[model samples]
Target chain A: MTTRRTRLSPEERRTQLLDLGAHLFATRSVEEISIDVLAEEAGVSRGLLYHYFGNKSDFREAVIRHAVEDLVAQTAPPAEGEPVERLLASLGVYVDYVLANLTLYRSLVRAAAGGTDEVLALYEEGRAALTDRIFREDAQGEILVDTPRTRLVVRGWSAMTEEMVLSWAEDPAGMTREELLGVLALSLPALVELTP
Target chain B: MTTRRTRLSPEERRTQLLDLGAHLFATRSVEEISIDVLAEEAGVSRGLLYHYFGNKSDFREAVIRHAVEDLVAQTAPPAEGEPVERLLASLGVYVDYVLANLTLYRSLVRAAAGGTDEVLALYEEGRAALTDRIFREDAQGEILVDTPRTRLVVRGWSAMTEEMVLSWAEDPAGMTREELLGVLALSLPALVELTP
Candidate 1:
C-alpha cells in the first residue's frame, strides 16, 4: 500500500488532490466538505492530505488556484493571425476551457458569490488582463478612446462571454459552436473597431 | 399587536419579509439562513410567515421572484426614442435599477447559485430576457450585419452589460454609473448606429 501510494510523484499527487477537491466542492458546498472525506476518497492518508494542504479552506484555495491557472493558460491570447481572428481564437479557447471545467468554473463563481476575497481578486485580475489586451490591440486606431472606454468594452465582452459559456455548458446541443462563433465574428466590428 | 399588524396590509407584510430575507441571504449562504430569524426580523409571527410562504424553498423562491420583479420594474424601457439612444437609455435604466436594488440583487445572485434546478431555471429565464432585449433592438442596416454577425454582437453586448452590473454590484467605487454608461455609449457604435 505504501509503495503504491509513493509511486506517484508529489506534483502528480497534488494534481490528483485538486481534481478530487474540485469535484467535491462543485457537487457540495465548501462548508459541507471536510478533510477526512477528501483523504478517504483520494486514497491518501489524512496526515498526507494535511501535509499537502493545511485544511479545507487551504484545499479549496489550492483547487481554485489550479483551476484559474489552467483557465488562464488555456485562454492565453492567440498569435499570428488577423486581430479579429486572434480574438475569435481566444473565444474558442474560452469556450472549450469552460466546457471542460464546468463544475470547477461554476464553483469559482460560487466562491465569488460567497465573498471569498482571493477568488474575487483572481477574477478581477483575469478581467483586468482581458481589459488591458483590448486597449493594447486597439491603441493605434482612433477607434479606441481612453482607458475608460476600453474598460467598458472589455466589461461588455467579458459579460457576454461568461453568459454564453454558462448557457453552452448547460445545453450544449441547443446551440452549435459554429453558429455561436459565426455570430461573434460578424459582431467583431461593432465590438472592436467601432468608428468614431 | 393586532392593530399594528392590521396597519400594514398583507402585501406590505409580504414585501417586508422579502426585504429582510434578501438581506440575510445576501450576507450569508442560503443554507445558513433560517426562516425563524427571517420571520422575527420582519416583525411577523412564524405562523404568518408560513401562511404566506409554505416552506423554506418556497419562501426563498418568493424572495428571489420579488427581487427579480423589482429589478425589471425599475428598468422599464423608454417609451420612444432613436434605436441606439433607446438602447443606451434602457442601459441607464438597468444601471439605476441595479444601484437601487443592490442588496436584493446580490441576494438574487446568491440564491441563484444554490445549484438547485429551480434556481438555475430562474437564472436562465432572466438571462434570456436580457439577450432578447439586446437582439430586439439590434439595428439592421445601421449595424450592417447578416444573421450570424448580429447574433455575435448581441451576445457580446449582452455579456458586457451583465459583467458591468456584477462588478458594480460587488464594488460600485471600482466603476461609477456615469463612467460605465459613458464607456458603453462610446462602445455602442461597435454594435449599433453611430450616426443619429
Candidate 2:
C-alpha cells in the first residue's frame, strides 16, 4: 500500500479506495481484508469504506476488476515495436505482474476452479479479456492472430502460460529468467504457426 | 452401475463397491453421495460399506484415485504404432474418457482449485502421474519427451489440452471431434520444438 493524501474529490477517493483494496488483496487473503481491515489500511472509518465501495462483495469484485485492469494495462503489448519484440516485452511484464500479485493471481485461479457460478463467470470474463487483448492490433493496424483456430490456439496458449508460470513460481528449479521468458514468448508463435 | 453376481469374494465385493462409487461420482456431486445413499446404491448396509472403505472421506479419496487410474489406463498410449499415430489415438481416447466422466473430472478440477491441503496434494500427484506418463518409454524404449525443457513443454501442453477440452465440452462451437483431436495432438510437438 502507498501513502495518499487525506482529502480528495469523491471520485478520486473511490478510485483510491479501490486501488488500496486491490493492493491489499494482492498479498492478503480475501478473508483477511474485511471492511474493518480495509478501513484500517486506508486510515478511514468503516462507514467511509462502505460509502465508497458499497458492501464487501461489491468491494471485492470492484477490486478484482481493478486488479485485472492493472494487469491488462501494465502488460498491454507495446504499440511501436517489432511484433515479436512487443510480445516478448509484454510477456516479461506480465510475468512480473503476476509475481507481484501472486496471491491474487492464485485466488483468481482457485475461484475459477471451485467458486460460485457468479465468481466463475467473472473469472472467465477476466481471462477472456486478457486473451483477447493479446490479439488486438498494434500501431500499424496489424493483428498478431485472428481466426477460430488461432483463437483456440491463443486460449490454449493462455492456459499453458498460466500453468508454466504457476509451476515455475512454486519452484524455479534452477531455471534462469531468460529461459523462462523464452519458453513463454517463443512457444506462442510456435503454436500459432501450426495453423494448418 | 453394473449388474453384480449374487455371491462375490470379499476382494471382488470391495472392488465392486469402489467401482460403483466411482460410477456414481461420475454424474453426482460429492455432497449428494452420502453413506446411506452409497449403501443403498450398493445394495448393502451402511456398516458393510464403512467396513469396506473405512469412512466417507476415505471412500471418496479411493474413488478419486480409482478414477485417475481409469483415466491413465484408458488413455495410455497404444503399445504399438507410429509415434504421431500413437499420440493421436491416445488423445482421442483421453477426450472420450473425460466426456464419460465429465462431472467427476470437473469436481477434481474444483477440488484442486479450492480443496484442502490433502486434496490439493493428491490432485498434484495425480496430474504429475499423468504428465510423467506421456514422457515414459514406449514399447521400443523411446521416450516422447524426457528433458527438463520438454517436460515443461509437455506439462504446459497438458494444461492447454485441459483448457481446450473443458471449454469445448461446454460448447463444441460446431468443432468436429477430429479437429479438436488434431489441435490437442499436433500442438504438443509444435510447442516442444520451440525449445532452443
Candidate 3:
C-alpha cells in the first residue's frame, strides 16, 4: 500500500478519509467494501487509514459520525423564525440532505439494520439528535406540550420522518416540500398538542 | 432428499411451510439462508419447499404476508368502542405480538429491506393494510387530503411503527404502551381531523 511522505493536518486528513469512506460505504455494502479500497480512493496509504482510524470498524464509525454531524449541522432549525416555519424549514433541510446523500443515508440505515453493535448505537445516537431538534423550540407558543410528552411526541415524529424519507428515497414522485409540510402540519397537531 | 409418503391438503402444507419458514426467516439474514435449510427443517425436500411457494423469493413473500396477516388479525382495531381505546388496544396487541415473535417480525423487516422486486412490492402492499385500517371507519368525517400528502402521512405512520417496535424491543425499560398511546392521543385529533 502506498504511504504518505508527509503528515497532513489531523482534521483535514480525518475529514478527507471520512469523505472517501462515506462514498465507498454508500455505494456498496459495508462488508463488501475493504479498508484498502477506502485508503486508496483517498490517496492515503492503508497504514495511514489504520493509524488514523484504528481499524475497519472504527473507520466505519467515524464515517457514520461524520455524516451524521453534517446532517445535523445542515438541518438545524433556524435561530429565529415562525415556529412552524422553522420546523418546516428544518424538515426541508433534512429531506434535502438525505436526497443529496442518498447513498450514505442508505448505508447508515442498512448498518443499523444489520451492522456491528457500535454502528447501531451510532445510528441511534444520530436519530436522537433529530428527535432533539424536532422538539427543541415551541411553535411560537402555539403548541403546549409538557417535557415528558414532548419527548414522546418528538420520538414519534422522528421515527415517522425517518421512515417517510426512507420510503420517498426508495420511490419518489412529485411530492414537494410544501405538500409534505402541509400534510405534517395537519397530522402532527392531531398526534400532539403542538398548538395551544 | 426424502419425500412425504402421505398426501396432505395444499393449504395445510402451505401453512406448515410458512410457519417453518417464518421461524427460519426471522432468525437469520435473508441472504444468509437457504431453501435447502428451510426444506430440511420443515421435514420435506427442497422440491417441496419450492412446490408450494414457487421459489425462494415467493416463499419469503409468503412468510412476510403470513406475519403481516397475523399482526393485522391481532391489531385490527375493534369495530366498536371509544376510538382512542380501540386504537390503544390495537397498538398494544401489535406490541405484544412483536414481543412474542420478534424473530418473525425481524425477518419480515429484513425481507422487506432485501428481497426481489416482487417481494418488495408485496411488502408495500402488506404495509398499506395498516393505513387502510387507520382511516377505514370514520374517514368520511375527515376532510379529504391531497393524494400526495395522504400517501406521505400513510407511509410515514407505516415506517414509524417498525422503527418504534425495534427500539422498544431493544430497550423496553423506558417505553410503555401507555406512554406511546399518550403520544398518539396527543396527535390523533390533528391526524384524523375534518377540514372545515
Candidate 4:
C-alpha cells in the first residue's frame, strides 16, 4: 500500500514537528532522542527536519523555548483580582503546570543546570518574565523603593519558590499543595520587606 | 635521573594525593585532569594511584569529599558567641572560602547541576552539613515545630544563599559583601517565621 502525503503550510509543518518533538522529549531525555527517529516518527524526511531546525541541538533549544513560552502564557495572572489573590492564582497555575508536565519540567531544570547557552537563555527569559509578573503584582500599592536590592530579593524569592516546588514534586507527601502555595505566597512579602 | 620516593603512612599519602588533586582541580576542569598526569605530577606510580582510588571517578569523588569536609570544618560556628553573631561569623567564613576557591566553587556548582552521582552526593553532604548548622543555631531558643515544612524552608533558604553568593562571585561590584551577607542573614529569620 502506498502512503498518501498531506501537504501543509510551512508554519503548520513547523508546529507539527515541534509538537511531535515535544511529545518525544517529555518522556525521554534529549540525548536519547535521535533526529532520524524524530523524522521517522513525524513522517517527514530527515533533510526536512534539518531544514526546519538546522541540527539536533537547535531543535532541542527550539522545543525548550516553546515550552518556556507556554509556561509564561499559562501562568500569567488575571488583571481583575486583588494583588494577593492574583499572586496565589498565578502560583497555583504555575504549580499545576509543573505537576502536569513533571517530566518536561525536570528536563527544563536539568537543562538550566548544565545545558547549552541557548537553553540557559530560554530559562533566564522564563524566569525574568515570572519575576516581573510577581514584582508587578506584589508591589501594586506598596510604597517600596525599586532598586537593585529589591530586584535581587525578588529574584532570590523566585529561586526559593522554584526550589520549593521542585522539592515538593520529588516528594508529594512533604506538604499539601495549599500549604506549599501558602508558604511561597507569604515569603514574597517577607522577602520584599527584608530587602535592604 | 632517579627520583627519590618518600615513605609515609597511608593516611599521610592519602592527604598528599588529595591536596595535589585539589590543587590541580582548582585551575582545570575535571575532564581535563587525568590519572596519568596526576600521578606524574605527584611523583607517584599509576598503580599506587589506583591502589588509593579504584579509578579516576573515585579519585575525583575523593577530592570533592575532601573539599566539602574542609568547608564544613572551616565554616563551623564558634562556641562562645551569641547565636546571631555565630551565624554571621559562620556565613562570613563560608563566603570567604568560596571567594578564595572560586574555581572550585564553580566546579562544585556545575557538579551539583549535572555531574555524576558521586559528585552530587558530595555536594549534598556539604549542603546538609551547612543547613544543619543553621537550623541548630536558629532553633537555639525557639520552640518551633520540626516539620517537613520547616525543613523545606531551611533548604530553600540555603539555596537562596548559594545563588546570592554565586551571583556575587560573578559580579562583586553588584553589591557589597556586607550587603549580601546582610540580605541572607535577615532572610533567615523571616523564612523561619514564615515557615508553616
Candidate 5:
C-alpha cells in the first residue's frame, strides 16, 4: 500500500489520519477495517495511530465526529440570507450531502444504532448543532422566547427532518426532492405554533 | 440457576423463551446474554434454543419483534372512541408503554441504531402500524388520498413522536406527559392538512 511520507504538524497529521479513516469507513464495515491497515494506508507507525486515537473504536469515533462536523458545516445557512431562503438552502444542502455521501451516512447510522455512548454523543451534538442553526436562521434577528417547549419542538422537528431525509434517501423515486423540502417547510409553521 | 420444569406446547414454550429473553435483555446488554445461559435459564438445551431461534442475533430479533408487537397492540386505538379522543388515547398509550418499558424501549432504539436489517425492519413495521392507526383514527371513515406525500407526513409525525417520547423517557421532568400529548395532538391537524 502507498503511504504518505511527509513531515507534518500534529494537527495536520491528525486530520490526515481522520481523512484516511473516513475514506476507509465509507467503503468498508467498521469491523472490517483494522488498525494495522489504517496505519499502513496512512504510512504511519501503529504506535503513532494509537497515540492519536487510543484504539480502533476511538479512531472510528473521530472519523464519525469528522463526518458530523462536515455535515453541519455543509448544511449551515449562509451568513446573510432571508429566513425562507436560508431554510431552503440548508435543506437543499442537507439532501445533497446525504445523497453524495450515502455510504458514510449509513456507517454513522449503524454506529448510532450500535448504542456506543461516544458515537451517540457525536450524533446528538451534530443534531443539536443543525437544529440550532435552523432555529437561529429562522429567527432572523427576531426575539423569540426559547422556552423548554420551544426546545422540544425544535428537537422534534429535527428528528422528523432526519427521518424524512433518510427515508427519501432510501427511496428517492418515492417523492421528488422539491416535494420533500416543500413538505418539511410546510409542516414547520404548524409545528412551531404547537410549541407551548 | 433456577430453571422451569413445566411441559409446554410449542407456542407456549416459544412465549416462555421470549419472556425469559426479554427479562434478560432488560438488565443485560445483548452481547452479555449468551445462548447457553438463556437455555439454562429456560430449562432447555442449547440445541433447543437454536431450534427456536437460529442464533443469538436471531433470538434478539425475536425479542424485538415481540416488543414491537406488544407496543402496537397496546397503543392501537379502541374501535369506539371519537376521532380526537382516540388520537389522544393512542398517544397516551404509546407514551405509557414507552415509559413503562424503558429498558426494552432503549434496547429497541439501540438495535435500530446498530443497523441490523431485521431489527430495523421490526422498528419500521411497528412505526408504520402506529402511523396507520393514527391516520385511520383521525380519518374516521373518511376516504383520503393515501399518496406518497401523505405517507411521508405520517411517517415524519411518527418519527417526531418517537424522538419526543424517547427524550421524555430520559428526562420526564423536562416535559409533563400531558404537555407532550398536547403538543403532539396540536401538530397533527397541520401535518395532515399539509399531506397533499
Candidate 6:
C-alpha cells in the first residue's frame, strides 16, 4: 500500500490530490481553505501540491472544476430505465450527492455566485449538460421536442429543479424523498405541456 | 426645479442620489463604478454622496437594495383582473423592467452570484415577493393552494421565471416578447398542476 501510494502515476497522483482537496472542500468553503491547508491535509508538501495545480487561484478553480465534473459524471442517467425513470434515478443520485456533501455543494454555488468567470463557466457547463440531457432521449413518445420555446422552458425547469433540490437537500427533514422525486419528475412534462 | 433639486428633503435627496447611482449601475458593474463617478453624474459633490451613503461598500449595497425594492414595487399586480390576468400583468411589467435595465439587472445578478450576503438576501427578498404574489390572490377559483408541495413548486417556478426572463431579455431577438410572456403566463399553471 505504501509503495502503491508512493508510485502513483502523475495523473493518478493529481486525481488523488484533488480527491483529498475535494474532501476538505466538502466541509470548508473554497475561499476559507488554502493550498497550504490542502497540502497539509493531503500529507503532501506545499511545493509538490503547487506543482500539480499552479497557483493559489488556479488550484482553487481546478478543485472546483473537478468537483463539478464529478457531479455531472455521477448523475448520468441510467441506461435501462424509461426516460422519466432514468431522470428520476439521476435526480435521486443528485439529491443524495448534495445531501452528503452539503457544504461542498454550497461552496460551489458560492463560487458560481462569486462571479469568478471560470468558476461560473464551469457551473454553467455542468448545468448545460443536465439541461441537454432532458432532450437527449428520442424515446418512442418523447414528450419534449427541441425548439426555442421548449428549450427555454426546460432551461427554466433546470433552474427549478436546482432550487428545489438544493433547498430540500439542505433541510431533508422538511420534505420527504418521495415528494422531492415526485416534484422533479412531474414538473418537467407538465411544464413542457404548458409551453404554448 | 433648481431650487427643488438643491433644497430637497433628506429622504428625497438620498433617493435622488440612489436613482442616479442605479442609472449609472445600469451601464456599468457595481465594482467598476465609483462614488466619485456617481456624484459627478448626479451633479453632486463627492462629500454629499458619501454623506448620503457611507463608504463605498455601503453605497453599493444601498444602491442594490434600492434597485430591488424598485423592481418589487413596480411589478405590483393589477387591482382588477382575473388571478391569471393579474399575474400576467405583473410579469409584463417585470419583463419591461428587466428589459430597460438590462445591465443593472445583470449587475445585481452578478452581485448575488458574487455571494455578497446582503446582496443575495436582497435578491431573495425580491424573489420571495414575486413568489408570495402568486399566493397573494384569493380570487375566485384560484388555481394554486398553499401547501408544502405547492410552496416548493412555486418557488421553483419563480426560479424558472427568473432564468427564462433573464435569458430571454438578454436576447430579445432570439424570442418574441409574446412567446416570452406566453411561457411565463402558461408555465405557472402547468407547473402547479403537476406539483403532486
- Largest lDDT belongs to which candidate? 6
All candidates in order of DockQ, best leading? 6, 2, 4, 5, 1, 3
Docking class of 5: medium
- Give lDDT: candidate 6, residue B188: 77
Q: How many residue pairs clash in each candidate?
A: 5, 0, 14, 0, 3, 4
lDDT of 5 by residue, B164-196 (tens): 888877865367888889888767667767654
Q: For model 5, state the Cα shift of residue B162 in Å.
A: 0.9
Error of 3 at A65 (Å): 1.9
Which residue window of length 10 is worst by lDDT in model 5 chain B?
A: B138-147
For model 2, which pairs clash?
none
True interface contacts reproduced, per candidate: 0.43, 0.62, 0.33, 0.52, 0.69, 0.73
Residue by residue across A1-196, what tens digits does model 3's lDDT show?
Answer: 7786877799997897787777885567656556788866667788888888888777767877888888888888888877677777887888888888887787677666656677778878878876665555773446435455445555666767777776677665466556665555555545564422
lDDT of 4 by residue, A1-196 (tens): 7698989999998888887887776677655565687877767799989999998888878877778888999998888877777888889999998888888887777667766667778999999988777667656445234567677776677778887788888885468899888878878777777665
Q: Candidate 3 regions off by >4 Å?
A: A1-7, A25-32, A39-44, A81-85, A133-149, A166-175, A182-190, A194-196, B1-8, B20-61, B73-96, B114-122, B132-146, B165-189, B192-196
Task: Score every model by TM-score.
Answer: 0.71, 0.88, 0.73, 0.87, 0.83, 0.92
Error of 4 at A53 (Å): 1.6
Candidate 3 per-residue lDDT over residues B12-78, each given as its tens digit: 8888777777677556766655577786666678887777878766676677677677677778878
Residues B49-122, candidate 1, lDDT per residue (tens digit)?
Answer: 88989998888777666666666555656767666676678779888776666655655665566457676677
Report the TM-score of candidate 2, chain B only: 0.88
1 or 4, greater by DockQ? 4
Once model 5 is optimally superposed onto the true structure by TM-score, how far is the C-alpha of residue B133 displaced, in angstroms?
3.9
RMSD (CA, Å), each prediction: 5.9, 3.6, 6.1, 4.0, 4.8, 2.5
Tell me how each candidate scores on DockQ against the true complex. Answer: 0.30, 0.59, 0.27, 0.52, 0.52, 0.61
* Chain B only: TM-score of model 1: 0.72
Task: Tell me how far the alpha carbon of residue B1 in candidate 2 is from the true structure, in angstroms, after superposition.
Answer: 21
Q: Native contacts retained by model 4, as a fraction?
A: 0.52
Estimate how well candidate 2 is docked, as a DockQ score: 0.59
Candidate 6 per-residue C-alpha lDDT over B1-196 given as tens digits, one digit per residue, 9 for 90 to 100: 3555357889997898888888997668877666888877767799888887889888888888889999999999888877878888888999999889988887787778665677788888888877777787733438687767777777777878888888887655356787678777877777776655
